[model samples]
Target: MLRELASILGLFRQPPQDASGGDRTLVAQLVGLLVEVRAAARSNKDFTTADRIRDRLSQLGIVLEDRPNGTDWSWD
Candidate 1:
């Protein structure tokens, strides 16, 4: 979750002053789609698939912590 948020924020901040809002919208949409896919994988019992998503996010400096309630994430 945070990985994509960071990605979106990073994208939005890429421009010195005014960023292209279109890129931010696209980033948000993509992030939501990926998160839904990851959630579906977890719901389907494909832990390996879910872990792959988590690992990929981690590689991007985003940390994910799973709890009984849900998953929480942060970026370095």
Candidate 2:
């Protein structure tokens, strides 16, 4: 299922000709924020906060799933 979704998104994942360092930095920052929030929720054992974070990401077109190993996230 995820492979199919990735294939679909691949059609839209064109490389930017003039990408800058800032783009990578911004992406790193957002990922860091997500990790921090996830850690906090886990530390507090607050599933509600974790669910809210997942739902918010969903609203932004990202899907977050809690798997047996850990949490997985993807964007569409």
Report the number of the highest-lDDT candidate: 1
Look at candidate 2 and give me any clashing residue pairs. none
In Å, residue 62's CA in model 1 sits off its true spot by: 0.4
Residue 52 in model 1: lDDT: 81
The Cα error of candidate 2 at residue 46, in Å, is 1.3
Q: What TM-score would you give candidate 2 relative to the actual structure? A: 0.53
Model 2, residue 57: what's the lDDT? 57
Compared with the true structure, the alpha-carbon lDDT of candidate 2 equals 0.58
Question: Lowest summed lDDT over 10 consecutive residues: which window, candidate 1?
Answer: 11-20
lDDT of each: 0.63, 0.58
Candidate 2 lDDT by residue in tens digits, 1-76: 3235435644224333333566545544564467568768977999787766666656546566777777666654
Q: After the best TM-score superposition of candidate 2, give how far the Cα of residue 55 lies from its true spot, in angstroms.
A: 0.6
Candidate 1 Cα RMSD (Å): 6.4
Model 1 agreement with the true structure over 11-70: per-residue lDDT tens digits: 434532343667746645654565667778999999888888877766655466777776
Tell me the TM-score of each prediction against the true structure.
0.54, 0.53
Best by TM-score: 1
Off by over 4 Å in 1: 1-33
